[model samples]
Target: MESSDTTVVRASQPPPVQHEFALRFTSTPRGARLARRLVSHRLDEWGYGYESPVNESLTLIAAELAANAVQHGQVPGRDFRLRLTATSGILRIEVTDTLTERVPPQSVPEVPGDAESGRGLLLVDRLATRWGTCPRSAGPGKTVWAELTDAAAW
Candidate 1:
């Protein structure tokens, strides 16, 4: 008599998944606040908890970039765009505005000790694995982007 046997094998790596969220908001302080809240909500939907470090960091980055867009990049009758994309163990957050003349400084600037503002990008630089500004792909504006790489967060 002959015996039957079965062999099982599993994939060494899981398939790559990509997630994206994009929206345009009025260039106002209220809009900026909404952008930050939505980013946290979307990240929660994508598997990161509200209290997770990844969620908190990305939410803060979104708030800062959105605030900058409203304060410095706002244009009359124009809106700003917020985009979030996660793929291949990386998460990218981008804020695009209609104002093109103003661009973010290449390096973080020193803030006066008594200044009431101007520390957003500094916080972004510290939290993001990578961050920068680039001309908007299809419009007259700039897109400030920051990326976080934490495999466990995905």
Candidate 2:
């Protein structure tokens, strides 16, 4: 029997997650290396082993971003920050540096005929599902970020 009934369906939303790891390091070679190693250790603790492709790619991504922060975004007397976030099988890595300019390139840049470098972002682009840059949320700087799924595309 079809009576006058208007059934209202309410969609459910999952509870918010606050899983995040963050750190600050000086804009130096050692600092970039530390960021990379820490990312590997943290991902392993989070259930992704050292040999896991997801961990490998994420660590590389972190290294590249941190290196960029030190090489291109470095500002005198300013430090860089690394933030790792994991939620629902997604891992996000962000490296923020004191320079507001010098956004990370979306596509690979054309290298000179005799150049031996300038390919870090190309690696990041290929490994990450998505990557981009943004102004630092709490400082006068910029943050370059990349996201990877549990099954990373790398």
Candidate 3:
């Protein structure tokens, strides 16, 4: 959704518009699904889609990030926030949950030889230009963010 807040520019020039979308969802499997769906829609709106390799890569990244927030950062009665920010040359995705101390493992977890789980962050790490976690600016939780640059945006 569009934000009402605006940034002022020179009187002679219109303000630069930034594309952004933010939403909070329950820390559940359903929430993660919705987050991924919305991101895919937004990506398509921004002209990245089935034919664009960037679309497939970033869509998977968003899904993995959202899933991590639900699986590792879920707290009773707490919801997670997924925010999307995009410009011509960059796109950033951030997922925040009420879990200040539950940072992602320092390195991607290695799955056992026969295990059926543990690859989300591995995919994120490989696909994103950069990804990391930081304490939320004004809350008890932390935010995990990843960015994809111009080279990956096309």
Largest lDDT belongs to which candidate? 1
- List candidate 2 stretches off by more than 4 Å: 1-15, 110-114, 152-154
lDDT of 2 by residue, 19-97 (tens): 6789999899999999999999998887789998998999999999999999999999999999999877678999999
Model 1: which residue pairs collide?
Answer: none
Highest TM-score model number: 1
lDDT winner between candidates 2 and 3: 2
Give the higher-TM-score candidate: 1 or 2: 1
How many collisions between residues are there in candidate 3?
A: 0
lDDT of each: 0.93, 0.88, 0.84
Candidate 1 versus the native: TM-score?
0.87
Candidate 2: count of backbone clashes, pairs at least 3 residues apart or interchain? 0
Candidate 1 residue spans exceeding 4 A from truth: 1-17, 151-154
Name model 3 segments beyond 4 Å from true: 1-17, 151-153
Candidate 3: residue 22 lDDT (0-100): 92
lDDT of 3 by residue, 30-95 (tens): 999999988888878877775577777777888998898999988999999998887657788999
Q: What's the residue-level lDDT of 149 in candidate 1?
A: 87
User: What's the lDDT for candidate 3?
Assistant: 0.84
Candidate 3 residue-wise lDDT at 19: 82
lDDT of 1 by residue, 58-152 (tens): 99999999999999999999999999998878899999998889999999998898999999999999999999999999979999999998747
